[model samples]
Structures are given as structure tokens and as C-alpha cells.
Target: MNSEFTIAIHSLALLAYRPDHMATSDMIAHNVCTHPARVRKVMAMLRKNGYVAAKEGTGGGFILKCDPEQVTLAEMYRLTSMGSVKPGWCSGDAEQDCMIACNMATVMDQLYAGAEKQMIDYFGQWTIRDVLEQVRREQEKKPGV
Candidate 1:
């Protein structure tokens, strides 16, 4: 999987952790180890989808517009990235018709579709709050806070 989902979820979880404050793209990029621009791109998509609201000026940044408990991972996944799970087979030459090349694409398409559906269904089962809670619980079990 690409880093978009991880970035999106991590960014959201960070916001969820501090629902009262705004999260800047720079701060999010630092946490996710990506460029600020990438975070901005994802945040723009989230904002467009009504998941976040952007603020301008001095203390300006972004804040969650939707309830953490109501926001599902599946929703963010669909919003932030393209759904293609893997690359499909493609023949190098158009005239070089091969049975394997022709059949592989169809086979891969079905497999990818099934896998994508299962992933989306699994993500649909959890909300942002669930993920944040899980992370907090895991952190609590560590040697130190």
C-alpha cells in the first residue's frame, strides 16, 4: 500500500488527539515523515470532502469538521487516494497477442477487485476514534508514558 492512507489516518488521529486545536501541514508532515506539500494535498482533499475545515492567518491550520466517531477509515481511503491495489498485466506489443497476457489482466482485475472490496469492508468496521483509542491503549502498555 502507498503512504497516502497512512498519512491521512495519522494526520486525522493527530487531530483527533487534539480536537480543540488546529493541526498545521508542517506538523503533520513532521509526524508522518513526508513533505508539507504532500500533507497539504491530502488535507485539501479532506477539506473538500467536508472532513476538515481550513483556517487562515496567524494561528491558522486545519481542524476536524466531522466527529471522529463518525469518520470511517474507508471514507478517508476513498477520498485521499486512488483505489487501485496493484498493477495489471500489459502486453509490450499490441500485435503480439499472447494468451497469458490477455488472460492475466482479466484474472488480476478480478483478484484486485475482490481484495479491494475486502479491505474497504474491513476499514468500514472502524472509525477514527477506534484507531486513536487502540493507539492510546498500546502506548499505555509501554514501559513509560
Candidate 2:
């Protein structure tokens, strides 16, 4: 997985925590430790998908448009990634004729598919609310938190 998945989750969690407040992309980028443009891109995608609502100009930003508990991590993953998720392997034409390379590629492809399936299933089991609870619990366990 790439940063988009984590960023989307973090962005949504921030919105979920501040349900009544609007969060700018800059604020979200600060929290996610990424570029504001990336956050804006993700936020735009989320907004287009009806997961968030955006407002322009002063005192305007983004807010969650749907219930956190109703949105699964898998949904966020799919939305932010836009269904372009792929295996972490590169296959060139030169290696296609090699029996060993061909076999390994096939095996790796299957493994990747299995791994992705498990990950999607795991994501399906948790919502943004559960993630927030986990974060709060961890923070409370910290020495100064």
C-alpha cells in the first residue's frame, strides 16, 4: 500500500474527531506529515465521493458528510486509490521467456492477490470510529497524554 491509504484514513479520522469543525488541507497535511497539495487532492476525491463536504474561502474547509461508523477502511482505501492498486513487482518482456522467471512471477502474482484479499478483509472489519478509539487509547497510555 501507498501513503494515500493511510493519509485518507488519517484525514477522515481528523474529521471524525472534529465532526462539527471544518479542517483545511493544510491542517490535515500537518497532521499527516505530507504536502498540502496531496491532502487537497485526497480531500477532493473524498468530497467527490460524498464522504466529505468542502467549502471555499475564509472560515471554510472540509467536514465529514457521512457517519464515521458507517464508512469502512476498505471503502476509504478503494476511494483514495481509485482502484489502481497493484502488485509490487515489475515484469519486463525480456524475462517473459525465462521459465524460472515466468514461474516466479506467476507465484508472486498469486501471493500478492492473496495478500491484498486479506488486507481488504481486515480493513472491512474496522471503521473510522474504531480507529479513533484505538488512537485515543494509545494517547491515554502515553506518559504526558
Candidate 3:
């Protein structure tokens, strides 16, 4: 749910479209309309998560570590959004035994848990290849003005 998650997904989806060629950070940034540094930062995270591999010389860039069909959005979300959950109605104290605390905090916690489960389940159903196909279909459907 952060920019990193979105950017990483975008980068992977782009790579999925062209699996045979490595994509440079600059090229990915151009598609993202952002700076190459930003792309590299996200790429580093993806690399750490074993989703991408990078090369270190001229004519080198990034490539998928595995097949796009093997990468699920749930895995990407877990990698990019680790330790990023926070309850909306609770203070810094995530665990308090007060009666009032139990009411609102419990409801909020359950809501967040449910939301996370829904997100994971939804994303787990699709792979990067599915996203690329959807993007391609959408692009093909645009009418000329």
C-alpha cells in the first residue's frame, strides 16, 4: 500500500512484458515517469526479495529471478510492506487491556486483519503475467481521438 509496493509491481510487470531482455533502471523509470534513483531503490528491494536480479556492467540491467507466472502479488505485497501495519484508532500502544481499549481497538484490529487477508487473498490469485495481459488488453482498447 506504499509507493514502493506500487513501483516494484510496476517494474516487475514491465519486466514481465519483455522477459527475454533485461530492463535498465532508466528505461523502467521512463515508463514510470520518475527518476532512475527511485527505480533503483525499488529495484534493490525487489532484488532483496528474490524477485529480480541485476547485472553490473554495460548492457546490463534487471531481469526476473524466476518466471512471471510464479510471482504472486501477495508475495510482492508481503515483501514491500513488511512491518507496515498500523491500527487507525489505536495509539502507539498496540496492546492495552482497558475495557474501552478492548472495544474500539479490537474492532479496528479485526478490520485491519480482515483487510489484510482480503488483500493477500485477492493478490494471491493473480501473477505478474496476468497483470501484464490486463495492461495490454486495456491499451488495445483505447479509441483514437
**TM-scores for the candidates:** 0.88, 0.85, 0.84
State the lDDT of candidate 3 residue by residue for 87-144, as single tens digits: 4346333366776655776676777878888888998998888889899889989997
Where is the poorest 10-residue window by lDDT in model 3? 85-94
In angstroms, the error of model 2 at 11 is 0.7
How many residue pairs clash per model? 0, 0, 0
**Residue lDDT tens for model 1, 1-145:** 5777888898889999999999889988998899999999988988888888999888999998889999999887777544658564443343447877557666766777889889888989999999999999999999967
Task: Name the regions of candidate 3 deviating beyond 4 angstroms.
Answer: 83-98
Deviating ranges (above 4 Å) for candidate 2: 82-88, 91-98
- In model 2, which residue pairs have backbone atoms overlapping below 3 Å? none
Better of 2 and 3 by lDDT: 2
By summed lDDT, the worst window of 10 consecutive residues in model 2 runs over 81-90
lDDT score for candidate 2 against the true structure = 0.86
Total clashing pairs in model 3: 0
The alpha-carbon lDDT assigned to residue 2 of candidate 1 equals: 70
Ranking by lDDT: 2, 1, 3
Candidate 3 to truth, TM: 0.84
TM-score of 1: 0.88
